[model samples]
Target: MKRKKWMSTLLLVLGFVLYFSVNEPESAYAMHIMEGFLPMGWAIFWWVAFIPFFVLGLRALRKITKETPELKIMLGLAGAFTFVLSALKIPSVTGSSSHPTGTGLGAVMFGPLPMSVLGSIVLLFQAVLLAHGGLTTLGANAFSMALAGPVVGYYVYRWMMNASGKQKLAIFTAAALADLSTYVVTSLQLALAFPAEQGGIAASFLKFGGIFAITQIPLAISEGLLTVLIWNWLQSYSTNELALLQRQMKGVKES
Candidate 1:
């Protein structure tokens, strides 16, 4: 089972790389190439982008597996849920729609490692079926949305939960922060991909950051509230579900 898991991950990574290489563009960044806009540089970028997250994910996995079997199953289910939900898109303006992405919720539930793997799966499916993001951009997109978002959200949520006395308040605050952090990190990724000609990284960041922030702010808030509501409701009515969550969290801690 362990070897099979590793092999499956390897195959997915290789397949992801191959798909991007065949479809990427020369000068354009992969993130900018929505759908059907393939570039070679973008392909190279995707390959380069995988290194850090892959390392982090491996380390995380090593740490995560030291827990109870039931916890592991819960984490797996959370990842699967995130993968499926994120693939469902809602209409937005600017000829592009938006989706929940689910990184924040996944991070809250299972931490970052599993979320990275889950995020990669979600992006892969989005590229292959929905044609939302791109094959070449999958790695970069996953890094930004899955890796960065979850890491940020996890830490932020942990901090809030630890600092606060009230559970509801902590959950609400964490949810909002996580959602906003996801969008901010995603914006940073875009800014890096589409740097301005005149000023440099800072200037490009400001420009792209402003536009992306305006576009994503409302969506982020809505997602945050929705996540909190759903999570709280689940925790309330579903004793088994809450027990499962606690088990997974214990596993994560032990690992």
Candidate 2:
């Protein structure tokens, strides 16, 4: 990126956002399902489903710490990024708003398993301190935004990197697509729990997905750009540290 290219990208994303916001009626702020909005069974199910990922992330974190204690600060900063970015809700054309997950950067940098723990903590803090999401729906939210998004994002980035050897392109694609993936999983969760009377699960999923895409797609594009900018800055200033992380990742892969 050149400055002109960057401006063009920003303008395009802004156009999408403005088009949706102007076209659709103002809606409720939404990212994770509102606190305690899901049925008890659904909530419990998501919690159970998320437990394995959470535990695996803890194990991964422990391993990383034992190997590279210097990375702890980086991990903390990544978690903070996720928390802060996700807290900013973009109103959508649908009745609910959406926001960026900010998990893709962590997934690309530290790997997805570690991000599961990082993302879970961010989500937890948001629910408890900010009242953005609910305790009861934590599991569902964690499953969708934390585990699912990061897993897909990590693989997507890796795949793109391997194929193109273009870090910026890979980062943008991973971040944007991962954000979309989170909402897709979220729509599925909502559909499964509350199927529409006419079209059932499929119909309900489309309804939810269409609604969230209004805000989410543009937010995803914006997040992708932001991630690239931040990563480029870090790469320029922290070349040695970034190399160390890359070496650690290589070591993990070899093992």
Residue-level lDDT tens digits of model 2 in 1-255: 556655665666556445434543344556788787899999999999999989999999999888888888778878987887787677766667788889988998898889999998999888888777799999999999999999889899989988999989999999898788999999999999999999999999998899888778778888888778767766765677688789988887788
**Candidate number with greatest lDDT:** 2
Stretches of candidate 1 off by over 4 Å are 1-43, 55-67, 71-73, 88-97, 247-255
What TM-score would each prediction reach against the true structure? 0.71, 0.88
Candidate 1 residue lDDT tens string, 1-255: 656655654565455335334433333322223653435675467658766776777676666666434456556656765564455444433434444555677777777777777777777776787665787766667767777777877777777777875655555555555556655666666556667788866787776556445535665665565566556545655558568666767666786
Clashing residue pairs for model 1: 24-38, 24-39, 24-40, 25-38, 25-39, 25-40, 26-40
Candidate 2: lDDT of 187? 93
Give me the candidate number with maximum TM-score: 2
What's the true lDDT of residue 141 in model 1?
71
Model 1's alpha-carbon lDDT is: 0.61
- Model 2 residue 86 distance off true place after TM-score fit, in angstroms: 0.3
| Regions more than 4 Å wrong, model 2 | 1-27
